[model samples]
Target: MKLIIISGRSGSGKSTALQALEDVGFYCIDNLPAPLLPDLVNQILRDPDHPNKLAVSIDARNQHSNLKQFPDIYKRLRETRRLDCEVIYLDSSETTLLQRYSATRRKHPLSDDSQGLQQAISYEKQLLEPVSDLAAIRIDTTRLSLYELRDSIKLRVARRQEQELSLQFESFGYKHGIPLDVDFTFDVRCLPNPYWVPELRGYTGQEQPVIEFLEQQPEVQQMLADITGFLEKWLPLFEKNNRSYITVGIGCTGGQHRSVFLSERLAGHFRATMDNVQIRHRELN
Candidate 1:
């Protein structure tokens, strides 16, 4: 059986991710007690009618002591040769989490009259460290819309083949905060800026005009070659190390031109030799 453990702070889109998996036929449970994980697995394995894919959400709502015991429980689960388990931890910036709660007018799971929302958010981070440390994939959902988050959970988590690394090339604007989930970040701000050209300003890196402009710059080609070469040399090592996912962040002043173009080029290059390659232009969406 394949088990996916979904966890994160409140308002970080954990519910959306769990729902996405459930939509794809994963039998999902929300707010499951951390201590019951072993029992849950055993029960599922014994039942002939059990679903092959199981997803559960465990968060700060669980008992503090139970949450602290997660690491040992996870270690034992990993030792079970027949059971395949992956933990997907979702988080967002504190400000973003605050904004989400305010927008939705929902009560935080750990908030009360004595402890404010901000304090609860901060405390939850400390409380869930055990589970977060065991996560195979950490998703930062601060800038992702609900639809984008759903698509990401479906494509990056649900559709990924077992033991194959799900590699993602994401482009973003430096004006916006750097993505927290990326394993590596490349700054392309030093490269030529197509946004300066009046005609190309309106076009994105994916467009022919902007693409043509970037292709003509010698520096752009050199940067692409350098980044591509670096990944080519290192990616094999990560695969050999049994990595399940890798996210590379490429950023420019604005996501429209340089970063997006480079991300597209890199993804294309890796896709030629790798499976499960995906590209996302954050500002575009």
Candidate 2:
């Protein structure tokens, strides 16, 4: 059986995630008593008619009293059955969580009625830390829009089924700086400034005029040539290391022109040869 334990700090969108799982055909139960999880799993393992995908939510409602028993239960479950268990811990910033709770007008499960929301948030974070650490996947939902979260979950499910290497590119402006989380970064700031050219000032590299001008430059040609060869040589090593997603960032002085062009060109080139590729320009607009 495929068992997934979904837990998070009180207002981290666990309920929303559970709903998404249910929509995807998972047999999901929310706010399940932690102590019942072990027995539930055992019974399902013993039963031939049980659903293949089972998801359970555990949170502040029943977690504090039963939290201490989790480690042992995890160990016992792992030892007894041929089961694939995954823990998904959802997390969001305290401010975001507080807003979510206030917006919903729901009392915090751990709150002392008069306790400030921040204090309750702190307490829940501490309480959920252990199980969160044990989770195979941790999702930080602070900055994710609902659509983004839904798409992220869909990406995870698709990747699980395909087991293919995923490649992502985030193009950025040098003025805004390179994306902090990029695995690979390229500086196109040294190339000719398209911002200086009045014709290309408002137009993006995706346009034919920008492409034509960029193609006319020798430096642009040489850089893409070298970068492509370098990526082809090293991409296999990343795959061998079992990387799920590789993010490459291309940056230019303003991010409006050169980096945008190169990023698009590189994405097209890589997609033509590689298994999976996604590209985004952070300042293309």
lDDT of 2: 0.76
lDDT of each: 0.93, 0.76
Q: lDDT per residue, candidate 2, 1-285, as tens digits?
A: 777788888877787787777778789899888889888888887888888888899877774758767777767765766676767778887778989998999988878867777898998877776577666556667656776666555555333433356776767887765554467898877888777888788888888888899999999999999888998899888778645556788888877788888888888998886766777676653
TM-score of each: 0.97, 0.68
- The best candidate by lDDT is 1
Given candidate 2, what's the lDDT at residue 171? 75
Give candidate 1's error at residue 284 in angstroms. Answer: 1.2
Q: How far is each candidate from the true structure, as Cα RMSD in Å?
A: 1.0, 4.7
Range of the 10 consecutive residues with the lowest summed lDDT in candidate 2:
154-163
Segments of candidate 1 deviating more than 4 angstroms: none
Per-residue lDDT of candidate 1, residues 64-173 (tens digit) = 99999999999888887578998999999999999989988999989999999999999999999999998888999988898999999999889988888899999999
